[model samples]
Target: MSRSFVKMNGLGNDFVVVEARGAPFRPTPEEVRAIADRESGIGCDQLIAIEPTANADAFMRIWNADGSEVSACGNATRCVGWLLMQAKGDGRATIETLAGLLTTWAAGPRAVTVDMGAPGLGWRDIPMAEDMDTRGVELQVGPIDAPHLHTPGCVSMGNPHVVFFVANAELAPVREVGPMIEHHLLFPEGVNVGFCEVREPDRIRLRVWERGAGETKACGTGACAAVVAASRRGLAKRRATVTLDGGDLKIDWREDDGHVLMSGPVAVEFTGVLP
Candidate 1:
């Protein structure tokens, strides 16, 4: 049977949103890959399935373009929250995922804010192969005498992330080093790689290599994790604007609540029925 889907994006990180609230819509791994194929199918960075939930408005299932099922995706959450809020004619919505429950609200016109919960800083939380200092994990790239990126901060905003403080985000070798660190033996479960350049205490430039999706135009959780990593390393403030390749995102690591709030605009690219 054919199913209707909405193509949405936060910044330029796109998704194929399938609402499976009324019926089951479980696609095989190959189907997911096909749906995410840019050349032949309805391409998207991730395929999101919105299913009925008892605790929250919906349960979001995330599948990467490579067909790997992941626990969390912040950009997809904002897009889903916007859709739910539009349907309910309200500004607030709750979404549940393997990461946990996320509360979101309409920040402004076509913009949404999501409380991404507290960041996990423990070595066990990042779940490295063995215990290590998460603030600046022992990892390096390039030659030992002149390393390109080293001593990255490790944190988990629902998923594992390793952020390198670079001098220029544009110069960072995302394609070459990203995959090398993503499949690094230390991460074990694989990890998202972020190259962050702190422009000021309040602004940051970032680029991300997502675990299964390669380098997307933007990554919401990656933005949040970048800010958190910067703050932890004392390079930036608790709250800052993360400038991604596609656009900017306002990220606030709230001091009182210990929750990370991410605000950004969402867009509906198009809608169609899956063939």
Candidate 2:
């Protein structure tokens, strides 16, 4: 049977969203891969399924391009949040995910702000293979004389992330080193990698190599992780603007509540049905 879907994007991280709140819509891993195929399928960084939740506005299920089911997706959350608010004709909405419950609100006509909640910093929370300091784990790349990337800060914004502070984001060798670190033994369940360049205390430049999605135009969770990591390292303020490949995001790590708020724009690409 065919299914209807909506295409949306938060920044340039796109998704094909299917609503199955009233009925079951389980797609096999192979099916998800086919739908995410850039050439033959609808093409998207991830596939989202919106299902009814007992405690929140809706439940969001995320599947990466590689057909891997993940716990969280910040960009996709914003997109789904905007859609839910629009449908309800309300400015606020809540979404439940494998990560947890997230609250969202309309920032503007096309913009949204999501409360991503507190980040997990413990090595066990990031579920690292061994216990280590998350602020600067003992992982490095390149020769002993000069490592290309080392001592990355790890954080779990629902999912696992490792942020590498680089002098220049453009020279971070994301394409070359991303896959290697993603599959490294340290992160037994794998991880998303972010190479960030702090331009100013209030501004940053970032690029992400998402697990299962390769390099995307943007990553919402990565941006949140970057800010949290940078703040912990005294590289940036608790609140700052993160500039990704697609656009900009305002991230605030609120001290009072310990919630990370992510504000950005969302766009509707189109709508369609599965064949």
Candidate 3:
């Protein structure tokens, strides 16, 4: 049999959005892994599935390269918005995921805007072992001064995240410290970790190590989580620009509606049939 997939990317974090709505086959974890493999398959950071939705545009499911299903993906969600917009010939998209229903709009020029819904701030939401304050939880990884970085603000952007507001962005030892903290004992389910530096009240620098996906070029939910962590700590405003290693994304956690809005561009790299 044959399979069809679309190559898509939000910022630089890319995915293979497979529309298996009416197809004969649903991709197995092994198949998804093959498709995400750089040496064998299509080579994407993640794989997305657009399935049926009872009352929404479609169901957006995210699978990491390792074949683990993830709760949410902001950039891939925008890519879904772009694809669905083209299908309906309109400029809006509403997608259902494990997180919830998300509303999206097309911004001018290459960007699409998505209402990612409000973040869930709690130990259980972030799925920590115990209940700690969301603003700043006591989490010590390695040491103190030369420590392996600690005290992260835990939040859930449909999935779990731990954001560390640091004094430096580039020198924070993300590659070393991130993997350790991600699998720390407190986060029994494992967690996506973000290192953030507040450049301004409306701008921040972010680097992320995602659960099941490692350190990708970019991450939308990580950016949203960083913004929320900063906002809760009074370090940043609700509306802020988050600069990732791949590119920049605008996030607005609306005060009135309590929805987190993310704006970024998605690129369709290529498409092909699966054997």
Candidate 4:
């Protein structure tokens, strides 16, 4: 038996999207790991399984390269939106995930705009282990060059995130503190850590170390979370261009809708059969 798959990327955050609606078999953790293995398999930052849903849009599942089932993935959502648009000839769309129904729209050339719902900013909502005032978030990481790194703004973009404001994101010890903060006692569920530097009122530079998945070219939710965090900090405005390693994402936190709209490019890399 074989399954068809599409390899796509949103700002180089690659994904292998498998449409398993009519398929009889689901991918195992090991199999998902293999598919995301660049050396041995299809190669991707993550693997997305698209299954049928009842009350909502298509069911979307995320798997990390290590084969762990994750809660949410934003770039993959855009990639899947592109894949579905090509397959179903779409103008607008929605997807069901463990989080909730995610809405997407056809926008810009090679770009899909996703309404990533609202940012979840609560002590228990972000699902942090202990009780802390989310209105003014706090954390305890080892040594940071700056003291403020410990008290980053926290939010959940379907997945957990901790956005730290720095003078220069590149200078921050992403590889060092990222792992430490990701596995910190506060976030029992783990989290994607982002270092953000405000370039302007409408621009920010971010470098992310994703949870489950390590450093990648870009992270859509991370970008959104960063913008929201910056907005809360009075650094960046409601709309900001988040510059990631791969490219820029236009994030607009609509004043009326209250949805974080992520706009970015999606590119088809290749397609193959799953053996």
lDDT of 1 by residue, 19-124 (tens): 8998999999999999999999999999999999999999999999999999989999999999999999999999999999999999998999999999999999
Clash-forming residue pairs, model 4? none
TM-score of 1: 0.99
Q: What is the C-alpha lDDT profile of model 3 across 130-242, one tens digit per residue?
A: 87897899886665766556677988999889998789888877888788888888899889999999999999999998887788889999999999999988999999999
TM-score winner between 1 and 3, please give it: 1
Off by over 4 Å in 4: 140-148
lDDT of 2 by residue, 117-193 (tens): 99999999887999999999999999977998899999999999999999999888999999999999999999999
Model 4 Cα lDDT, one tens digit per residue, 167-274: 988898888888888888888888899999999999999999988778889999999999888898788899999999999999998889678999999999988988
Report the alpha-carbon TM-score of model 2 versus the true structure: 0.99
lDDT of 2 at 125: 89
Q: Tell me how far candidate 1 lies from the true structure as C-alpha RMSD in angstroms.
A: 0.6
Q: Rank the candidates by lDDT, best first.
A: 1, 2, 3, 4
Poorly placed runs, candidate 2 (over 4 Å): none
- How good is model 3 by TM-score? 0.96
